[model samples]
Target: MAFRRYLKPRVVPQEVEQIVDALPHHNVGSQGYDPWGLNLDTAKISFTAVRWLYEHYFRVEAHGLENVPADGRLLLIGNHSGQLPMDGVMAAYAIATNPHGPRLPRTMVERWFPTVPFLGNFINQVGGVVGDPKNCGKMLEREEAIIVFPEGIRGSGKPYRLRYQLQRFGHGFMHLAMEHRTPIVPMGIVGCEETMPSVTNIKPLARMLGVPYFPLAPLVPLPAKVHICFGEPMHFPDDARDEGEVERRVERVKDAIRDLIDQGLAKRRGKF
Candidate 1:
């Protein structure tokens, strides 16, 4: 759905509220994380927000969560869908409230997000840091679980007609996993693309409105049921040191996610 508003942009809290309203509702004050030696409360809020989104806004049916390790610096690489970042939110929610227990996963967010008043505060409070190489390395060194969508913006912004094809992922995440000897866990998120069938992009309009990007969808409020599937953890040999090997492993993980997305899509389709 195309959202064109001509109202004057409000300031601070109001602006934040407007942004939040434009997307899904979340519980912003519940979970947190410790990164860069800074004990930020934003992580907890982010966790809570995601949990609230699953509990209230979206009907999420998660499977194969037993595949996630209970602890360590694990990398979760997944397919990014939806015009917005709701797919990430749904995955975060599944991890936090796994039937096994409460475990918070820290995510790397874009640097630009935190500069937008309350939105920035909210992101930081939820343990989301700038997607800088230095910060990502630091988090890995600390043995914290990290979630990355290596496709950058492409996976999240693909045209509706091209849903499910894995985008070209940056090698940073694979490099980090090899360096830290962390396992790469693959996650597949379904239904978000159907929620908002964003088929086109209006970049100039987005810039004029001071937003990152604007999407055109067939539905205003997406009613698609969301599903998240976690694949078996894939481990890299601690002594493995070849760059080509790393790339191959990353592709394997990507392939697994694609399969899961297909499975999820089929499962949801069968139910109807």
Candidate 2:
């Protein structure tokens, strides 16, 4: 008689809802109000969190902060390189720590992030909203400071093959800027690439874990010193009403960010 073996079925993991019930609840429609709004109090809290992490844990150095506007609807465009989303957190910290009437800029993040377990809840608490065009427009309409990484996940997940090189930026941000007449500020973030140098891809594991993409970084602890530099605000020409003209302005912003990154990398070569 042949021996028979029985194996238990494997359990497929389902996405767990991670929304924080403890946080103050507000209608999605009333995202502009004080109680559930992007006001100074909330911004200060977020600033404190990021600052504490940077000072105590990362020791990040930030320069060219004057480039951030004191008040108005402005779009901060920057390169993403951190193995994790630490760059965004640090950028938020920078804005919150600005001495010249500091304000926490609302960040537009990937839509999928809100579905993650603990991360989604924490990001939302820090005033990070979904990176959809509609959400961006609404925030701009309220004259809020919005930060965006046009390269999306591709920039954040930059492989060792394309370190510091920017990916193709989507044009939706440009259209929103033109429509809202908001100034575009270009910023360059360095050292995040070194924090975690992604050398390979692990698709099967990433899928199993329910993450959009998984990266293999040889440098797990991120020994490189982190530095972020801001460039002078670049405004879109009001006279350029044509779509083509608007595109030119968008490209200009992208170029400015690229140039700043190159300059920053050059400055930090020996140290980083």
Candidate 3:
């Protein structure tokens, strides 16, 4: 009991503990774990560790968080960059700390992530789920908020020259939104592109590692000030049929994200 007390305070400071404890956890079992593998204790520790990066290091500025619904299933779609998943981390932090309604949004991670030993379980404990449609559907059915990067590796592995220019978005998110009748909150993330700009990708290395792409970038992300703007919630009719209709809906969300990105870029004073 003494050891537990010592470990908890050291790993999770009182301030960080309060911040995490304030988050609305839904469907959590008596053991502090949800069906999707979210462990409340694990989440508290992870949040405490990342709080420094989100607050002082990156100095993330979030706007339009009021637009995110205080309750109900939500889809937070955004552009991906930084040669890593830091953009998703910052966005999730912003939403989790939002004064209006603090909630831990589940982030959809790449399939390759689960193939890595230990990393997969660590991710799941911190509220990350494999980017599978079936899993996402189940979460939505339970009225959970999810963060999705439709650009996938294409955006994250893009060269520095293509930074801020969103890559092609997959239509799967649109299809899910339409089917679930969930509100889509378009998010624009800036500064992450410069955090660890990739000059090129080594396909051979990526193939050997069995990952999407191996980026030629810094080992650690530079502390680039990040800006995350959440746009007004967008809704699509559930009656959509045909691929073209879904594509059109996806395009609309992309446009909204693009506009928000432009705004964030304009508002940015410096990269670091």
Candidate 4:
């Protein structure tokens, strides 16, 4: 009994076979039928795997999902961490594996993300778009839920000592929200900072290689329970367009996320 208790959870063979069986459905996007290059079948399969990690490994529990509207132009802004961008994966997973049904969130990634050969191609198949104003506006128009990390590369690659400490969020998302009049939902993801701890950023080497941040973390991430809390959707009137006004609204979102993060952190039993 003790040995069984310590054994890793069994990987369901049926689910794995189901995902493998659907590979043929991936034909939909191989020809670029969708501008975003998203293959719904592929996404479903990918989420199946991600859901396994979320359920058994991280044991992620997403709160306040109802706060997100069922249908509308939505922007999900959040804190990013886990040098591997697993925080983003977990956040995406939280939305994708909703109790009702699977709903993959359209995530915006750095431009350099798609330049990494096979990794880049996989990202495209699973609906990770390059971060840019044009791409964002288009996605919002499609009424898709987009997950944006305003902290960008900084949030993902910050030093281990500074984990959970938010960095400055750029003004792009703020401007996008106001322009499209889309509701912005702030999400705070806890436990990622502890999962993939970064020792330091190799700034010079990262820059030399044209990467945003080259930080060192364990070869495999540690198991950490993740909590994703979604704040109520915040509406920004179309009237606010000035730079100063935009900055203030951006701060409001950041403040909202910070508060949510604190709330999530307070609930941890063993900081797991």
Predicted model with the maximum TM-score: 3
lDDT of 4 by residue, 1-272 (tens): 23322331343245644443333232244553357777554555566678778999999889988787766678999998888778888887776545543455778998898888777867877778889889989878877778899988888888889988999899999888988989998999999998889899888999899898878878788899888899999999878757898889899999999999997897777656
**Candidate 2 C-alpha error for residue 48, in Å:** 5.3
- lDDT per residue (tens digit) for residues 1-272 in model 3: 35434666678888888887888877898888899999877777788868989999999999999999878999999999988899998999999989889888999999989889989988998999999999999999999999999999989889999989989999889888988999999999999999999989999999999999999999999999999999999999888778988888899999999999999999999889
lDDT of 2 by residue, 1-272 (tens): 01101110121111101111212223324443332233323333444455556776567777888888877788999998766778888887777667664665778889888787766655665578889888888777767788899888889877877988988888888888877888888888877777777877688998898876789886454556677888998766457767777667778887898888877777674434
Each candidate: what lDDT?
0.69, 0.70, 0.91, 0.79
Candidate 1 lDDT tens digits, 69-150: 8676788888886777787777876776666643556677766677778776556555566778777777777667778888
For model 2, state the Cα shift of residue 195 in Å. 0.9
Better of 2 and 4 by TM-score: 4
Candidate 3 Cα deviation (angstroms), residue 65:
0.7
Clashing residue pairs found in predicted model 4: none
lDDT of 1 at 195: 67
Q: Which ten residues in a row have the lowest lDDT in candidate 4?
A: 1-10
TM-score of each: 0.78, 0.78, 0.96, 0.86
Ranking by TM-score: 3, 4, 2, 1
Off by over 4 Å in 2: 1-49, 218-221, 237-246, 269-272
- Colliding residue pairs in candidate 3: none
